[model samples]
Target: MKKGNTLFFKTRPRVRSYAAICGSKEKEGVIGNYADITLSDDMYGESTYEKAECKMLSGAISLAVEKGGLTDCDIDAMLSGDLLNQIISASFAARDFEFPFLGLYSACSTMSESMLLSAALVDSGFACNCVAATGSHFASAERQYRYPLELGCTRPPQSQWTVTGAGACVISDAVGKIAITSATLGRVRDWGVTDVNNMGAAMAPAAADTIMRHFKDTGTKPEDYDMIITGDLGALGSRILKDLMWEKSYDISSNHVDCGEIIYKVIEDEFQGGSGAGCSAVVMNSYVFTKMNAGLYKKVLFAATGALLSTVSSGQGESIPCISHAVELESLAAGAQ
Candidate 1:
């Protein structure tokens, strides 16, 4: 079951269906067309930005369940997380669903955490259907982690834009074209990076650690997976991870891609790019999964990175500890292509 820091799922529960929903800014990103629903208004009709994030998260869950041909009653459990105090976005979203909910908080890496937990539940015969979801909002996250939106504080070149979106996937016991085969749970790594604004630097070490462990545990190499996509860690972090892996004699530079780097358009002036639970969640379920469904990709290793830093920790001048969780997604029909 557990090898090194990775978990090899024997059941291989299928990701039956999924949905990615986002706002106008994300709609302008590279994979915008892949999103299931793109709203013109970032608010989604909510009075507050927090409430809007809640809407996006819950809406993604409902959308995923519906697309999977299941209703709320069929979902045995819901696993979710977000970037907010007490993770209110996920908890508030859970209020709209009937299933049991578990609020997870792993910073931006929560999407992979939720999915890994959901697959484990189904694999253990504890649940037949599980919904894994998470999200974040630029407005809500900015005020909580950095500054208030009204202040209009200037963002640094190294800073990442918290994606205003949510993504959800319905994992079921029923066999499907796509399945989660394994997961590499990350260990917290701290490189003494204290800048809260530059999350990519703070999280890249964890990403490298998990990737190396995954290859060792599974007896696979960089070429085993078609693509190795990291969650956030934006542009600079991706480069750092590559350098670190290269130092370890594992060259992943060729097939490696960072979710943050590709999430937005280069012309958007978003600096490095997007970072949030929603970044990888939406990108995988929408863009990456869509490509897999089309038989364009066979196997992918999705590593969602997160900086485990609290506002209290940052305020206290503590270094940021980071983590990443990698899930292996394989397409059943890839050989047919």
Candidate 2:
């Protein structure tokens, strides 16, 4: 936990750029505007549940390649993961892209986890460059994990809306070196929060724990970073996390932001709280990347949190367990003036 610039000084590999690609299936939902779904109608005509994820992953990778100004062949490798059982989304995406592949699964935290691994690979001389990650969600997730949307079941205020979008990021050693400097993996935390409907409550503890650990391990304070962002802990979880941090004396209230809350713009009654895996993915790809490129912020801590629960677990009366992945990204370019 000794924090000084050791990570930077110990190794001087350059990190170039971080690019994100996003896709979604909900074309007409009230929250669709918050996402980046723009596929043709025909694409979804015969889309099976698995195909939807595959399409999203492929679209995300293509966009990342385009935005990063690199060809698929130029990519050193592709690292991806999804909510699917066998990671079909990533597998199919790899088939289309000619890069070596490494599939990952951290649930909603997959994007950050992939980025962390990709950066490490590039910095350690193992690989010159790689596309870190991507993710997707569909209406089918709810049907499989919860009740069908048609059931009209009322979601509690603490519940988060699953976002139907996919995101991809190209991480390289050549572009601008906006690399992931470090990462801290979180341990599973269950605070006796058993409301299957309220994921925010279940995930808040893990978010707080991981954020605290990141600061402790890196010897950095909240004020040291321009932004401290969390993945998808919605409104209620965000509030609880803020309180927990205060209790732990971190006091990150001012600079802290939640991807879930920010993605939906917190419109009144528009979305009960915020969104899902795609929420953090799209926000980082579209909004955060733009701001970083514009020099709006310098150092950021990206913490994506996930609720590790299933239909079977909840049905069997199991409490929701949660985890988070935190990574720090900083600008490495020299000429600011």
Candidate 2 collision pairs: 15-177, 16-175, 16-176, 16-177, 17-176
Candidate 1: where are CA atoms >4 Å away?
Answer: 334-337
lDDT per residue for candidate 1 within 161-254, as digits (tens), equals: 8888899999888756788999988899999999998899999999999989999999999987889999998998889999999999998988
| lDDT, candidate 1, at 12 | 94
Q: What is every candidate's alpha-carbon RMSD to the true fold?
A: 1.2, 3.6
* Model 2 spans with C-alpha error above 4 angstroms: 1-46, 266-272, 333-337
In terms of TM-score, the best-performing candidate is 1
Question: What's the C-alpha lDDT at position 333 in model 1?
Answer: 65
Candidate 2 C-alpha lDDT tens digits along 151-251: 97666555676765677777776565465677777788999888876787788899899889888878899999989989888778888999999999999
lDDT score of residue 174 within candidate 1: 73
TM-score (C-alpha, index-matched) for candidate 1 = 0.97
* Model 2 C-alpha RMSD to native: 3.6
